[model samples]
Target: MCWKTLLCCSLWLLLLKSNENLAFKIPSIDFEMLHELGFEVSIPDEPGMQRVFYMLQIDDNCPALMDYITESNNGSWISRQKTSLQNNDKLQISVLVQYNDEIYEKSETRVIINARLLTTRDGRSQSITYPNGEGECHAYLSPQKQAKRCKPAQSIVSSSRQTCQGELLFEDNFSEAQLNRSTWKHDIRQRMYHVEEELVAFDDAPRNSYVKEGYLHIVPIVASEVVEGSFKLGDRCTAVESPEQECNIAQGSFYSIKPPVFSAQIHTRDSFSFKYGKIVVRAKLPKGDWLFPYVMLQPVSTYAETHYAKQLRVAYARGNSHLQSNQQEDISGSHLYGGMVVWPHGRAMQYLKDRLSKAHYGDSFHNYTMIWQRDKITLMVDEEIYGELYEGLSFFNEKCFIIFGVTVGGFLNFDDSVLAKDVKPYLNREPRAALSFWQQRDTWAPTWGKHSSMIIDYVRVYAE
Candidate 1:
């Protein structure tokens, strides 16, 4: 029994010593293999020692597109290597096993996979090929493991085409150094009749409107001097007020407040107009408190307004006085109330109020699309449809132009009363708290500098 035990111990030590000197053998690999193939190494399992680990490393010469995986259990280690070789490529694989803090490295194996191209119904294809006949010719094996010679086929064929949502009718990426005068007009005027008075005087100044680095930047700045002429107020106010108080009054073109803000308003009223199309404006909105950014569509004629007036008269005759008042207010032609609108049919307007929570408009650029077809008008933010209006509205059938601008301290700007009712929950319930926040800024410079910019990347019109 003593002799038998001695023999067993000697055999175990010999086995361990042999394993230490053992070299890793190269495994056969087929060039035509579609998925992962397992290359394994066998090691002798010893009784009592520390945990064992195995690792596989591919040399740097391997193709940048190839990937691999490795695993180990008991005394066996495996490396699964996969590649869709369209070109003839060579790879060097090496394996290592560690036990009792001692590592054993296998001899590196060189694998030569031949190139082949497979085309599918989709329009995507890849190619792989060896530069020259420098590498050995390995037999291509089928999925059934049958050895065969791979014949390089002719050029691959694919049948696929690109499609667009609509035909592009008008596109302005603002690539020029200046605003394209042929397609846009700088609307220089002050709006006087809205709920919250606009504090900025619109002007043709390049400082307020310019093109830079492929973007149209419409900025608002503190006015230096009062504008020197008298101009007519917006038509809505003119229609509502008495002749003495409304329409064509002689007032300074300048804003009412001292050192008032100045901004730009540009539109395609005369240069371009469309009846029905998909309008897309890629823009980054202004961020300041009380700032209003608008991208609007308005009628080019009074046809819709005339029709709405007749309808209102008919409604009033039927004793629908409440609707007459509401409709009058609704179709007031106030561009401030919506980003996109089929005016006179005010219900079709897209207010963009719900989108305030989805993302910070001032932080990034977003695509605002208004698709106006014969039967429907859909509004989308970043390809996500947020609002839609079906047909049957006579107002939307007429030609309409586009307008883009930024207004500050307008109706959207919360005063003490509005802030108290709406924003009080967000603030500390103080009515004047919101205004006080802006007052804390030095000379109100930060308000204009940090948060007052409306950047338009591009505007496109697509037709069916």
Candidate 2:
């Protein structure tokens, strides 16, 4: 180091070490503005010549207290930890300032933490316990079901002294101007899902899906509107298997063309995927023949990402209104369905929990809930139990992410022979299924008015 710089640094340290004539100011605790578990330790602005450090130590009698140190941030220091301080405890904070390699203890300040809290070695409700009786206390917390004092309304874990059960894990209200891409990633591809072969292109275009007026609106549109001739998804498609086949389509014939309709599919696979939990969705079903809206799940594995593991449709609804089965039963948009795909004895099977309502699910908003356990799955609508499956979840041991989408004319979901009086437009085995659906859009497109949009008010997933 240069002689002049070294001499000035040494003099600065020596000046701060002196008790009677200090060069810089020491920090003080702002107990009056203290957080539940933090002391507002701050120091005044120091000159630009050299840096000053504030290191604080709690009294040894203070249980689980840890030391905190910080250089001034914009001329101040404020910090909080995930700990609690009991009420009416006299907290003695020893203030120290460090310059270069030297730390000098300036003075000690005594203040009451709060009126109702106290430090206790025993893990008591409303009592904070810190090991070693020093600096910060973040170790032990009570398991009570009540809220704690001085806790901010928004917190992840240990918001207060109380324990947590059925914590809300994830939620979205779609109140923003655009879809939360971080939370709900758009899967831009055509008929590439593990289950069901839909004659639809799931695009990332805002016309197919977007957030508006506090609701997530997923609308089914004609593919020709987005792409007139041969379609290619290019970089927007995330299909891992057969990217060329899954993400592109060439005009085959006048009647047989690219995926007949355009739609949207989004998922939480990138953001959130869990094994067992409770999921609730407030949504208005879509209206139109063969329009399928579902909140689905898939395991977070490459094999399951394609077609190898069991899946869960937390909730699903068909968009055909006034359709009936050949057995003289209602099989249309008025019913809600959810099922679990299980693999047992080298075979894959699916069991469903279905509910029928007097009104079309597309007519208004309804709460569709799914409670998933290790060995059971339950479905509900507006607090009423719909149905459940009592199968063990032993097939997949990995966490699964959430998926919500609106697809049109899938082979498996729409049974052509099931509809009585031949309401179905095309057979499941027909190669030109997409063209057939689009040709008859004059009859079905009228059904998909603005009210027919799949409107999701919110989706909430809670810990089980």
Candidate 3:
């Protein structure tokens, strides 16, 4: 070996040594001890722009990867690198593997990094409760067995006297022959009934109905026997454009009674409406198999003349036409335009029997309450909140009145046999279903309170 040969051999040896150092090597990373394993992340070096990072490592030897595929272990497939890892200049790789490059029988380490910010507070924080007691009194109602946890409906009258000094903003007791003249008076114009285009007298209906037993009731019916099955109910304000339009009342027995009967409905449309306040009622509901009992609340200023046609058109255009169906499956028939209100204010209506399971409406007295505050309306049955109004987005700006009545032919529209079972305690015998079947089949027409009586225990309104 001469001098040149020695020099060449030395250079080759040095190059080989460098290559050995560059070959695949197991990576080492800091998992920060088990207690410090929580990871933190920020936008990679570039705050407002996008960035990427990369990692490099060798494989290791072990059994199949499944057993090692866990948060603590990486098994065979190792996480090599993330494009833009930033904390320290050096890449601190961390991972476990069983086999290396499919050749080495020993374990190998690999780079591992969190892709996004690691929020250690993932669902570990408590919810903040903002105390808001000045709004209104709230209660809940449900069809389940009488709820055990509930606030009772009290006489807010005395409290109001203390709160407002007995000015008597509104007050009513059932013993009077007529509603208190001081509070206000509302006249619900008689609904127009027509056969084809000719105006007809729905003689059975009474004019200027009154409140009794602390409940406002109305008897809406068509009297003449011949026009009984043929007449229709239409909105007076829009009757010209919608002559044949049917209201939302379902076709069935109003009460279990026969023809030549009366039904009642009295609303505070003109006299009064409340913006933010509490309305409470203590009474037993009528629960005929097909009876429909409802507590309807509307934006007094926004929708006094809202018609069924307008409601159906909007509901239909919004792709909710199933509301037209009186299928026995949907007991509330609320999906129908009847219950859909411009909310921030909505009404609560249900099949009387369906709500209390086997207990009919009149079986036991229930304390029903509604608390309207700002943009929220909470409905309570027996003091527990059961339903709510979260739409409309409007708060109560004006005062509204309460209408409590028993109507016939709601969602159930079942035969008289079923109806008889629901309101058994109140009505006489079962109605004749065969005579009403064809009448009930017409989906476009809904009839409420043909021959029913809605009694009331008490009605009270409060303001805080």
Candidate 4:
């Protein structure tokens, strides 16, 4: 062959070699069959294929439940975690075929999982698709047994000292359209739960909390956004994760690994700090399963002040507790026991002594008052004493500020067994079931409605 012919022949051979190297077929994924069979599938073994895997993307509406799907092995796709899919949820499945550690071809499919099949009928049985594609199967879900409400115990009075009628040091009636930034610090941090063991996202946004109708309404609603990091600080404040640093007004920092349900938390840490006084909060608490209402005081030193003296923190919590036999006792429209905790010493002083009341505080407005003096700390509900500690007077000398908010599931009081049986099915894999279940309740609008709030009529501090 001539030089020109030889060059043309070489180019043709190179083209053939390139075509052979690029020769790969996209793997066909049976998504419809996979969805029907519960999203578990076995991929056919292909020669020269080094590895195979799948990626799942949930529809935008149900994006929070996207982490449920995972790859099990080189040839299978499996959902290792428990999840709930809502009606009309679209799941996008992408299958990647690789050879020599390089991606050869990718096949993708989107499928809708019917949610009606997951809803329980009479809170017991649910219809689900069988994995073998034989037919639908009915599974019985464990019933959520309601706990009996405790009978109202005899009211207990700790000290003969009458309710504090001292001169008012400060008060917030919440009469304005917006929160008073001068008096209250809106510590809008993302997923920072260091203060309490609860599932709640604290944000500065008005939707999570607001002042309206002459009431400071701190509402816990469904989360619209996900935030991850340490606490977000206010003006002239920096985030501190260690106790070595001296922060005059510090908010504890916590790392949240997953998306959380958003709520609101505000404090007087920077704005107001008092040594000893009478603090009274008149408010109506939120009612529903797994909700926690809190009015607390933390040392301005953020526990670091204990080096000078043991720092003190006092709080009032209600809704769920280990002292009570049934964690859901408060949500059954029955008795409400306001719990008091005084830490570094984790003590439930009220319930331990059986001095609680049976009043459903969620049904109406009630007063939660704390009297702190040099020698004693007392907690009362509606002017009736529930708990008191007389010996921890030295710690009470430290200046502490107030924090008001509500929270859901967390290490503090969440019971996973109860959750899986009673609330998990309805949660649909959403992380914050308390907020989700409360928003979906039929009585939410009629009974709670816009009033689904920790309505603070007034927060007053009285000094000697």
Best by TM-score: 2
Candidate 4 residue-wise lDDT, 1-464, digit = tens: 22223224532332222223456765444432321113443355566665444434444221121121122355543332122222354544444445444454343434443322221112211211123534322211112221121222211112223332233456888988889988787644433223233555556678778888898888777544333332333442332453222122123322233224556777877677776666788888766545566576666767211222133333333443222334434333234433233455553222221234455456678877776766656666665666666764654446677778876545334444434354421333344443344345443323434545677898877652
Clashes of each: 5, 16, 52, 0
Residue 273 in candidate 4 has what lDDT?
A: 70
Return the top candidate by lDDT: 2
Error of 2 at 307 (Å): 4.7
Give the local distance difference test score of model 1. Answer: 0.44
Q: How well does model 4 score by local distance difference test?
A: 0.48
Off by more than 4 A, model 4: 1-165, 192-197, 224-239, 242-258, 303-359, 415-451
Q: Residue by residue across 286-333, what tens digits does model 2's lDDT show?
A: 987778886777777742226335678877778888777888888888
lDDT of 3 by residue, 1-464 (tens): 22223224542232222222223333322222111112221111211111111112112211111111212222223222112221111222222221221111122222332212221212221211114443221211111122121112222332222322111234455667666545533322222221111111222133524666555444434333422343334443222333443232233435211222234444554555544456666654543333444445554443322332111001101011122223344323222212233322243222111122333344455666555555555555654555565554243344454544434432222223334243222222224332342244233123222223344566666552
Of candidates 2 and 1, the better by lDDT: 2
Q: Quantify all predictions' global Cα lDDT against the true fold.
A: 0.44, 0.62, 0.32, 0.48
RMSD of 4: 27.4
Off by over 4 Å in 2: 1-164, 192-196, 225-228, 253-256, 302-309, 342-348
- TM-score, predicted candidate 1 vs. hidden true structure: 0.46
The positional error of residue 19 in candidate 4, measured at the CA in angstroms, is: 99
| TM-score of every model versus the real structure | 0.46, 0.62, 0.39, 0.47
Q: At residue 168, give the lDDT of candidate 1.
A: 49
Q: What order do you get sorting by TM-score, best first? A: 2, 4, 1, 3
RMSD over all Cα atoms, model 3 = 24.4
Worst 10 residues of 2 by lDDT: 137-146
> Looking at candidate 2, what is the lDDT of residue 42?
49
